[model samples]
Target: MAAIIKPWEGTFPPFRMYGNLYFVGTQPASVHIVDTGEGLCMLDTGYQHSLYIVLDNMYRMGLNPHDVKLILLTHGHIDHFGAARALRELTGAKIALGAADREYATGELDLSYAKELDMTYTETFDPDILLSDGDEITLGNTTFTAIATPGHTPGAMSYVFPVTDGEKTFVAGLHGGMGINTMCREFLDAYGLSYDCRDKFQAAMDRLKEIHVDIFLGNHMQHNDTAGKYKAIGAGNQYACVVPGEWIEYAEWAKQNMLQMVERENQR
Candidate 1:
């Protein structure tokens, strides 16, 4: 029997978020394309089945797949890295993933949770670039600095870069992982994770607050209200640019939520 796919895993119409950034994936997983003048750099790839949607949206926007120079993955989750292999084959682009995720993706480490969820695993492939904390990846005029934001996964990485809306340029940050899906004691114990997982998650959030982010994004739409913000952008709302304080507020909210989860786990 085939597993039922969630509605959010379906395709979504792509739209330009700002100057060079475009949203081109479903509501469940976000795939962003940044035009770098010299070529294109992609951030995240939805499920493998959703690659056609991503490619079609790019084509509709008059972007050729051949022009894709880099494919940056936020993490090793199936939803985020599922289509990476296909994209690399189609575009011959250099694929990059955080060191930890790269190990998981290339079969160096086993992701037991994926087996528990009955999710499809990404085809093993060696990443062309292995990212580390404070590493910078430059392609043409765009430079993305990788920030180690470990919470969802040990190697979860966020990216900070400059994004423009033609009239103005703002420092944009895309948070790699936002959910505490594996934070519970049961899951942590089964996965052999240390009790300090919660503490590390909190520290990551603390470090994120220190970064000034005028435009904040998340790997999933639900994390940062991508659909809501996209609608506002379509309606010509200038407030869609987002403010730095909003990032701090969101980080605080995430931290509080995780802490609450930890409290509940303790009571259990």
Candidate 2:
């Protein structure tokens, strides 16, 4: 197992990303705040210790935590869902996640890999909304369609929504999980996952290619060059808004990377 390290300890200033979307996470986890016009919707929470960073960023952007009506998780990974319980308690927001990931979050299944890596997993609470593929999540003016992309985990989900640049509305996509770090035998044994992760990942990529994604976001910033894109946006670069086909290219690249990993493991 790789040594666990705190990679996202630093704070990042919150900024609006086009329309009603805001980035309010640290360097490691990518937490997105979406304004639905009725209430706020948070995408993913960082680790338990990173909760304060999220809250502080929200406040910095003139967003009240209490106004958050929904907390949507990408997966059940500790880094992704760690602050969910606390945020829900603090804001009374309804929490939602993929049904399969809910089992891992609610302790119905073991997540010993997290313990091995010295990550924290404190309390577990039931999700108010259990999501499935193709399910529509409507919150005021914002609506998102869930796409099951089970590679990072059995219940990993991607979301497709709309974002406007004050004039033209474009379809935006947020890939739920991108890492195949849990594909190793040791990690799978610890978590008791038996699915063919590589195959599922490829299938998910194939499905994603069919969707037109003008704006692509990832669960983690690094996955989508988030920091760089944000910098471009801040600098008023015309290409800051990515080209429409970038999502398909990214998916293809990710799928190929996973295939290479599988090949390397087979050689061993």
Candidate 3:
């Protein structure tokens, strides 16, 4: 199973989160492509093995390689940023990421702090530019901000943007942490990242209160399941998410749910 998922899985038009943002799932990761009007941008290219699939999806989305100006990454996980080098070669787009995660992406940093994942430094490339907290990226009338949130890894970041035009402010939760996945659940049980899951929960909760987030979404897979709103990522079926703002409510709940999961992991 590689990244070429059935086109039907995404349905037509893809959920237009906004006029500028969009997503497509590949085998190893979900590709977030953006059109800022200055040109195209992407977040988190898929695994090394699925490079072509990512490129193909870009074409499917009507984006040419040359249109891509920047590839902003969530964090340095291999699957998330592995295709960066290839995409860069094709598009000549500069890559942006948290300055702290630079080494982790290029394979200079091992990221031993993370529990079950054995991230090794294999090859390294410098980020053309470094992203810092509160920096706003403007594309004509639209703007997105970078928020620094550390837990999954130091220098982990989530992109926050307004829900839509005319909206005063609403941050889209991207890459703060995994809501849940096969690897994540298994890793939690196996590595036991924290003894105090409650602390982790509270920290995220506190952060949420400080921001004006009305919607929540996950890349790669589904993290929120309510009614027919979502299909869990691992499900081998076509699906899409709805009532997205409900996701933030789930994040509020995930804070507690994850704490419990951690508690169980610690006990295990």
Cα lDDT listed for each candidate: 0.81, 0.81, 0.59
Weakest ten-residue segment in model 1 by summed lDDT: 1-10
Candidate 1 lands at a TM-score of: 0.92
Residues 1-268, candidate 2: write the lDDT tens digits: 1212543446777887777788898876789988888999899887777788888899998999899999888898887888899988898999989987887888777661367556656667788999999999899888989999988888888998887656778787888787878876666766577758868888999999999988888777777777888888789874465567878988988888888887887899
CA error at residue 189 for candidate 3, angstroms: 13
Inter-residue clash pairs, candidate 2: none
lDDT of 1 at 61: 80
TM agreement with the true structure for every prediction: 0.92, 0.92, 0.72
**Where does model 1 exceed 4 Å of error?**
1-9
lDDT string for model 1 (4-86, tens) is 15533466778787788888888667889999888999998877777778888899888887899999888887778878888
lDDT of 3 by residue, 1-268 (tens): 2222332333322233444556644534666666766787677776655666666666676767688888878776666777787778878888887887888777665542222333343435678878887777765445768877555555566777654434333445664555433224554456554434345445755575466555555655555332123233225332333244555565577566666766776687
Q: Where is the poorest 10-residue window by lDDT in model 2? A: 1-10
Candidate 2 vs. true structure, TM-score: 0.92
